[model samples]
Target: MDLHYLDATPTEAERAAVDALLGSPEGGNGLDPGTVHGHGDAHNGGHPNGSGPFPAHGAAHGNGSAHGNGTRDGRDMLLPALHAVHDRIGWISQGALNHICRQLSVPPADAYGVASFYALFALRPRPSRVLHVCTDLACKANGSSELCDRLEQSFGPAGTAVDGMTWQHSPCLGACERAPAALAFEAGDPARTQLLAPAGTDEIEESARSGPADADREPPARESVPQAGDPELRLLHRVGVVDPDSLDDYRAHGGYIALRNALRAGPAEVIKQVTDAKLMGRGGAAFPTGRKWDSTASQPVRPHYLVCNADESEPGTFKDRILMEGDPFSVIESMTIAGFATGCAKGYLYIRGEYPRATRRLANAIAQARERGFLGRSIMGHEGVDFDIEIRRGAGAYICGEETALFNSIEGYRGEPRSKPPLPVEEGLFGKPTVVNNVETLVNVPLILIEGGEAYARIGTERSTGTRLFCLSGTVARPGLYEVPFGTTLRELLDLAGGVPEERTLRAVLLGGAAGGFVRPGELDLPLTMEGAQEAGTTLGSGVVLVFDDTVNLPAMLLRIASFFRDESCGQCVPCRVGTVRQEEALQRMAGGKAPPDGDDLALLREVGQVMRDSSICGLGQTAWNAVESAIDRLGTLSKGGPA
Candidate 1:
């Protein structure tokens, strides 16, 4: 853990802020239907019961009212299996969470909470080809709404070819400010939908799987390449530079050149290429990919592992979607290389439940790779190094983004995060040393191996090197994914994103995702670097830059964020469990019409926020006070009944 990025250990004043934010606290217990219907206040009553395990996808579906064979054991078998199916399909198009709940013996609230909490489960069966527009504050400013409208008009019942396509509003696909943005994937394919950005009607429809192509038909021409400024180019880049699923297409774009070289150079030389690249993890915590590989390589474990973290739930980041959908094979190739270097025989790509298409595509690609001799036993006829990969689905807990939590979720347990010490390299997945790399970081391996790591390292800053796939959103004219060198100024990114709104002045920018702190307009000049942001009292969390314009109220905004964390907290630790609820009460009280009487109450709330910050176990409790502190610091004078 780096000290510079973390603030001073929770101060008394900070603890007060946490407490104030959580004005009231609630208890944790199992959810009861009777209590839900007539109880006075379940809000303040207690935590709903959240426990147990079951199958992955053999449950029932329908409206909230039960319709299936109602047996306790039968229902239990059905729930997890239903979740598995829904996770794979993106929504319970044919069944409701309530139906699954009744069939599985889980409370409706618990079932619904699990369904709604994650991004994968959709209440309604989306269009055959789903397009999730990025509507987070950043993309909102970038004309994302307009893009959605355009898409709906063209694809909806009233517009062009309504035969197979459908469009729906998807919450943040994490590509904020990459506006006029959206991610497109087939509903049933599961293999096609990896997170993508800057995608709109034209791009989606162009590459969408409309129908089966003629088996004998020739491939499309590669003559017309799109320019960077072109809208289609932006969408293409967001979908990944290379489309790895198409062997012919990838070959045309110089796809297997790196793999051929890796096979020729052998594992040691391949490892050196990656080591020289200086590529850091694209997944928030910028750990070096080479070092992770080196540790795994040094260990003589027989079945070494290379797991790709594709569970992209960071509120403002979605670069992985592009890699998984556009060039999934790159990830496969990278993992294969890792297996060769580390003497590993297997790999897993942990994709979020929401991205069924990416999962499906990778699964298919893996099968194809095996047939083509790229994976399993001998690769392209070479002996000595053999590898294979599998896909694992996450149940949609944000905490699962934490590595240990991810492992637990994979192990068929509740997705609560775990404390880390015997770091992933030494102890991960079944007590074996593992290498878990971000989707983007693993994809970059092929590039680094093909080109020396030093060449790759030269693109970005000293500490943060290489081109980063930044999911830019909020208040910008053009919102979408941008691959730029690290340390780029906020102003430059904003400009590249087509600038902020003309009518509204800029307010504050949320760097990283929900866990990160804010930077007001005055701080726009702050360099967009991990170290630089830390210096300015914020961290580049998940690299999702969400900018807000003046129309947004900071206090109210902070309240919504606090509420989100409060609702999402797994309730494993008291500081986080009770403290978040308290924070919510304080924010509501302060924001509500009734203002606090001057001294003591205000002081108390502030103190609570600090204690929660200091005492909370995981990232959820620890940094959750960031927005509240920023809000109070920026708007103390404007607060109701305050000095103003």
Candidate 2:
């Protein structure tokens, strides 16, 4: 392998751009480029240049500039540096990485590690223009695979560059509402990107070749949000009605009322409201939001961190994207409240990189909030209560959705989950007390503070309080986000989504995302609550209800699900790394009508799943087997001899 593509050497302009962002000279701070790169190849087992894993360039260097502690040594420069390089050169070059490493005093090996960890950063060379077509469940159901095939037929192979363009299959672009969505990055300039839904060969070819020309292109109109029966739509109220970009429109529609109430009540009172409301983490753990806030507040640590996890990489889930894109200010305000309640002065919003629209909206929202004094020092004129937020974009790691993994990503390391015992509340985000809440979870903070926790708690089941944002997609007439209180049966929720398409009998539903399990058609009446899901051997994880009808191929779908886990395992631990691959292999065998020699691939899958669940490091590996196992047990895929 020539492997020259892995060697990214920054030009003079690229180096200058990095210097402007990092506020440091190239190879500054007495760091020698030769020394850094000398050890770099050793740290990460050497570059793909046939040397070995990249080497550990140097020991960990600590600087606080990135986190707002104001140390100027470029410690916080990792993400920005990468972005600058990617933007200018279209990909990270080895020269660029070395320059960044020297500027930030980050070891060359570590810098390379960070760069390679994210999915967006291309390790190998390719065209500046790329088309990211979502091939996840919802998109797949809507012909995303066929779309990929067509694009490849028109442009080139999936990952090959042709006519200054390359198309790659993405996990989920969070545009399930407009299924079969493809985000085209014109010549790799993000600002020049275009989102095309119901994309076919023609649209993809034109978008890739002509770069967003109006001629012969009819971009699909934005999907409309379903009208909620209740006047106060709660989460879904402002989704379609209010202008996402207009901060004034948000305020007119009652945007920061919760923040105002939170400031009046004080941090303790705000936390009490959340605790009283019985709100839980919407990111799937369902831990009490109030309890998390209280724990962080009680800690003696100073500068406690509040992280709003907007990674939202789950296959069938797009609710967080909807919330962030439609009501960016709400997420910002919710984080502000969270920062105030936790006694933190700073927060980080880790939005998925694929969500360019959501990311842009949030960036604008944060700037507007800061300008309006809702953020920054002494927010909203609250004396001694200062809070600000920073946005961190994820490159494309599904595991980063886990709280600890997200912490690692922000700290300028590979996105990998940390072992628990200390927990995030005790030691997180730079080894201080931290609270990592999902976008939906934090959004509820404002609602709880405004309505009082007890009043808010009354909406859902006693244990699972408040309306949950359920992402409904696939084989349904109305496939979109629906916010319903807990205890709403799956049947009722499906009915709200207009149920399965006519004449298509519901076969199975994958509740939660890839990490969640399957629910049989007979179990549609099961309440969409944590408790209800637990009793039914499924979970309400992330509130992703992906419906599948009789026309779908369950065996192939299971194979795809398994393949997702295998590709996304991060390879940190043996159990998850190896187990996912094994599970995928077993599924492939079964799907191919060629079970293992023993003819018990299902048994082997169960054994492997048990090991992963009982021993894997993080939820990624632990829950990796949930969907596959559920399919084998509930849907008769294996017994029926795989896909027709």
Candidate 1 deviation (Cα RMSD): 15.1
Residues 518-557, model 2: lDDT tens digits: 8887888999888999999989998888998888877778
Per-candidate clash tally: 70, 20
| Segments of candidate 1 deviating more than 4 angstroms | 1-244, 597-606, 634-644
Best by lDDT: 2
Whole-model lDDT per candidate: 0.58, 0.76
In model 2, the runs with Cα more than 4 Å from the true position are 1-9, 24-73, 187-191, 212-224, 228-232, 596-598, 640-644
Candidate 1 yields a Cα-based lDDT of: 0.58
